[model samples]
Target: MQFLEDPVLWIAEWLREVLLGWGASELVTNMTLNFLGAFVVGAMIMVIFILLTWIERKAAARFQDRIGPNRVGPFGLIQPIADAVKMLTKEDTRPKGADVVGYVLAPIVSVFSVLMTWAVVPFTQKWIGADLSVGVMYVAAAGSFGIVAVLLAGWSSNNKYSLIGAFRGVAQLISYEVPLFLSLLVPVFLARSMGVNDIITSQTAVLFAIPWLNIPIRGFFVLAAPLSVVIYFISSLAEVGRAPFDLIEAESELVAGYHVEYSGMKFGLFQAAEFLHSFTFAALMALMFFGGWQGPWVGTNNLTGWLLGGFYFMLKTFFFYMMVMWSRLTFPRIRIDQMMNLNWKFMVPVSLVLLMGMPLIDYGLRGQELWLKYLVLFLFNLIVGLIAFAWAARADRRVKTHTRVRFEGRPVAVMPQAPAAAEDETAG
Candidate 1:
């Protein structure tokens, strides 16, 4: 009956007992368990990656008003499996002058980099894969591997288009990473810890309070640092190469981008890496901004609480994942110049402002009441937000005027009108 409390640990304990009885060393048993846990988490992510394909397709279909993949299986449930088979059976090709080593290793590195990020994601208080003191830095380092993968794919492909796409990807990713890292600092500063679990624990109090009415909401970071959340999400979308930040993969421009020369399972791996990476960042967003697994009926002190916490974590992550999909399906892809301008001219500056402003606010408001602290912070954010919006509006107006003038100045050919419309009416 105790197994019902925390089935995962209970099963592990049972396995330990069995292994010990069989004379296995304690170190070996522990190693076995850790390996199994890592394997399980990795397998789960891969399975979810398959499901994401169907989910995104169906969501896009709904947005476009069409029935998607109904012919494959019940509600198209087996479509991903079918697609997997196609990828497996498809012909694999390599360009004649391609660098075989990097070409083959590129997709593997891309997928591995995405997989490593999950190692630090805290699913629940007890269910985390790792609780490193520098978990936040670990995630950042792991993500940088993706840049290497993109470069390899582009340079190794021996195609000029692939090289160009890779260069653009590198530029976009590196540019957006500035704001992403800066936005991440807000949560770390607020929580005063780098561990994901600590960050989640710090959010246990109410985020906002109306003291007079005695109304309060749970202390999710989103409510406290919405500008940080916005910056984080937008920057993450660019990092994932999702639209309108998808200029790296702009088919009209680069003809399939960095992976253009990849075929068969190699291409499939790149696609899988992308889907998983998007979901990973969404999970990170949920963990950082939405309180990870903290919600009603979720208790971390008890073993049974882990199960409930897992449910809440997945729910929050799915919500954010759907938001990512929505953005991809709804927005048109922007030009490379436009994308760069948005990052350098807007996102980077705003994130730097937020990163600088948060620490000052926290320092000044130290030891203050929660309500007063959040209130002051909120007011400060509002002021900065209003100013930023005004600047953006003015810039947009200027660009529009310039564009209109440039287009209006182009020569136009006038069509000749009928010579005698009035006389033709009587003649007819």
Candidate 2:
């Protein structure tokens, strides 16, 4: 109880008088606390990323009906640590013709960009690191640096395969960013704020229930626009380069892709960044759509609120991570053309329409009954979801019967080429 009552107050006091030799200003003291808090948060996130990697491997193993990483301490709990050690001790080799500077800088850039995005993510009311007014924009902007690093890694390797892989990555991420932003805008519009903290606080405000139905229709963009959430999840999957969207590292075609020439800890950095990006996106998705830091069945008491909020945030993020891993293990890698088609044709248009339509619907329901609002929203989403599901089912059926064949630098249907036109024509 005492420990919970004052976590860092004692340390703060000691640092103020002993280290600074004077009482610190409010800004300085707060800054110090923020840094300390960020450090702890950052460390926890890193550990979560490591654990998520193991979870992914185990999940993938289960999907494939194989045992994965079971030898390293209790169901492979220590597998990540062992992998880290092996990476640390292994030889760091550079390709003969590779550009040393860019080759060395790429992984650092990738990891750093991912870490920078975390700076603006608010864990709780008092636990934000920076609390930038443009928090979402900052996250979006910082995310692009990773794409740059990937491109550089591929280009500087002086390898054709790496260059192609990097180009694929650039194309995938840039195209998906459109839908990603569109879906993200739904929450920002509903909250009417650019700050992450403000968005979270907005979600906690309660709206009065309608007299008859008694459904409280307030806060939570997810309840308001479920389609946006679905779009955002799909766009995020592409953005993070996960399965069905992992053409950038397609083993069969690209031969390990952008980091083909990398080895040792350098390559380890890329792998870490991949896991980190996946984890970070999951966290962002939770924050945006799931009322981040909102506890499950908890009152608004200070300590309970903070702890529960963080717990819920982590729980949702980890669950999403599991979903990503499940998809990776269960689905085959989509062809590059199919990837592009899905993004440009379906995701972008649907996201844009939802982004525009949701706000209008929300506005029109300003003075309506809460039940009416929810009913309308639910019906709209249900109709759209049914349409999408039907389309997907039809596409799947087509894919099952379609024989994939490539000819003359393009994919096509050969239809068995009509049995080579029978040489008996000459005998006639």
Candidate 3:
């Protein structure tokens, strides 16, 4: 029964024994297993990336009231495969004066960084790539590689538009990380652990506790730290360059952004990286704020249970991924200035207060019932969120009023007319 529940572990153990029986060294056996595990993970991510392309296109088509990809295959299921073939066969090109090394490496690094983050994601209670004590920090570090990739692509392309896009991307990503990092700390604070798995484990306990009614309801961190989740979600959008925060590829301004000079499969790599990065953050949100691999009928002891737990985790992740797609389809992309103001002015302050204030609340409620602690935390989130929103609203109104007053007396400018040619005397 145990083997059936975790067949990978079972097969690995069986392989280990076989190698031992053949006098294989322990180090060699361990290395072999690790390599196989990594290969499986990498393959799985690539397969999912293919599916995401189809899904995003179909969803976008529906959003725009048009049929998408139906001609390519059944409901366009084969569209991604066809697209991949086209990308593979396209002529590879690089502009003159481009740095060969950075140009060649940039796309590879972009995709690799997204793949690296999956190392810490827990699919089921027992199925995780690595359960490092500092998994949170590792994820942060791995994700930072995308910044390097963007800079490399831009600087090596030798294009003014690509350089501008790369500069904007770095600024947006680095600025938003402040809020994103702070929001991440809220879960770390609540779980009192920096490990990803530990955070998920901590959520397995009481989800919600109502002291007034003496009723204990299941709860997730989202209920306790609603504001943190909001900040995390928004900041993550910018981090991944998703719209309406997708300033990285503001085509109207940058004509395809940092990857403008890339072609063939190299450009495909950038596309794959963007899609995967969005899904990765969605999965992270599920793990941190939702009860990852935790739901009714999810058995930790059996294979069926493990499979079901993975299903639930993916379901949660897909929900958020759809939310990202929905936002992309529904909202117009904001300007660069507005995006910066949102991160530096709003998300940063709210996240800082949440991060610093959460520990203090937990301290004051020391030795108290878990439910009481969560209740106070929930109320605290609400108060902070309300105050932040109110302040933002007031600031917005003030800016609007000031702009209206300043422009009220200004004269409307007329379009300049071109000089007319003199009438020909011969024609007269």
Candidate 4:
């Protein structure tokens, strides 16, 4: 039997005992502990948000081969806090025609929506805020409201550009949602549960064998649902308004998007929500496809269990987050039309197919040896990958061919068309 002990939860129990000793009723003590635990999680997320800004700036600078905010506090560690202070003290202007209620509530809703989703994510074993039975659905529903926030920000601002940005954001969100939801089904089906904790538990087994090595890395869905992972990551990028998918805020186009009228802390709230959402998606992706907090099965010890579990969770979450930042730095923003096509035409179809076939694959693999299951998963994924690669290669060739033909067809010089023989026309 696997032993699980969460230090955070343990501390909460101890605190609850103290409250009880202070004449608190059982219900009161439970509520106190729960609230305290929530506050701690919120505080941790906020601190991470602060640190993430500095990390992103520094990381982006390195990616661009330049020094970032090194002037502030030994590598600009305190730069984000300084920025936060400025935002709080900064001049704020509300549009004359702005809707007072929605304008004020937009940022709050945007920030809170993502925060609410965090309540279900498992940071460590037994350390989730509220592990709902329908955790996956809860996350999806919570995240979907982000579109409402964008629309509210845009509409309340009464700015044409903001409205356009919001419209684009809505289209993007709705478009990517199909694939995102479909990809989510892969993990849910494989895990045979809608609960996020149950899904994490289901990823305990290894996927495939390493060539020439007998090592078995865990997370069967990573192999069985490789494309889903790719689709989920891509969709999450767009959902969070990161680069390449940041059409919502294209400064060259939208002048800052749905939150254009927002200044200072209000604007900062939007930024905070974006980073937090992106990182949260990283954690969710890690949980669904990769083993969430399931590293080497360190038997539950007294105090060290929580620490070790958290270390593993953070390692996987950060790995995914780092990759997200890396992609943001590396990839240039694609055209909006191309982005739409990628989601609607490519990602959606692939995810749908994967979603439909998952059950069939699972059924076939039932009553089979572990190795046989692994082998079937490996082959299915390999075939899909190869087909995708072939299609991409062909598309690339056609694009290159068209470009070359277009360039060659253009005449460098045509003697100005010989001026249409002006003298002869005059004589006639």
* Tens digit per residue, CA lDDT, model 4, 1-428: 12335556556667877999999999998888878777888888988899989989988999999999988798888899898999999888899899999999999999888888889998776778888999999998998789889999999999999999999999888888888888898888888898898998887766565878777677646766777888899998988988889988999999998989999999999999999998899999889988777777544554455676778888888889898999898898988988987887678877776676667776887987656675676577677757866876787689779989989878677566555788778889
Q: Which stretches of candidate 1 lie over 4 Å from their true place?
A: 207-216, 301-304, 399-428
Candidate 3 segments whose C-alpha is farther than 4 A from its true place: 21-23, 207-216, 406-428
List the candidate 4 regions with Cα displacement exceeding 4 Å.
1-5, 206-216, 392-428
Candidate RMSDs in Å, in order, are 5.7, 5.3, 3.0, 4.9
Worst window of 10 by summed lDDT in candidate 3: 417-426
True lDDT of residue 105, candidate 4:
95
lDDT of 3 by residue, 1-428 (tens): 26776887888899899988899899999998898888888889999999999999999999999888898878989999999999999999999999999999999999999999988898998889999889888889998999999999999999999999899999988998888888988888888898998998898777464778765565678878999999999888889998998878888888988889999999999999999999999999999999788776677678656888899999999999999899889989999989988888899989888888989999999998877888999999999999999999999899889989999999879754443323444455
Clashes of each: 1, 1, 4, 0
The superposed Cα distance between candidate 3 and the true structure at residue 352, in angstroms, equals 0.7
Candidate topping TM-score? 3
Model 2, residue 398: C-alpha shift (Å): 11
| Candidate 2 residue-wise lDDT at 5 | 38
Better of 1 and 4 by lDDT: 1
Worst 10 residues of 1 by lDDT: 295-304
Ranking by lDDT: 1, 3, 4, 2
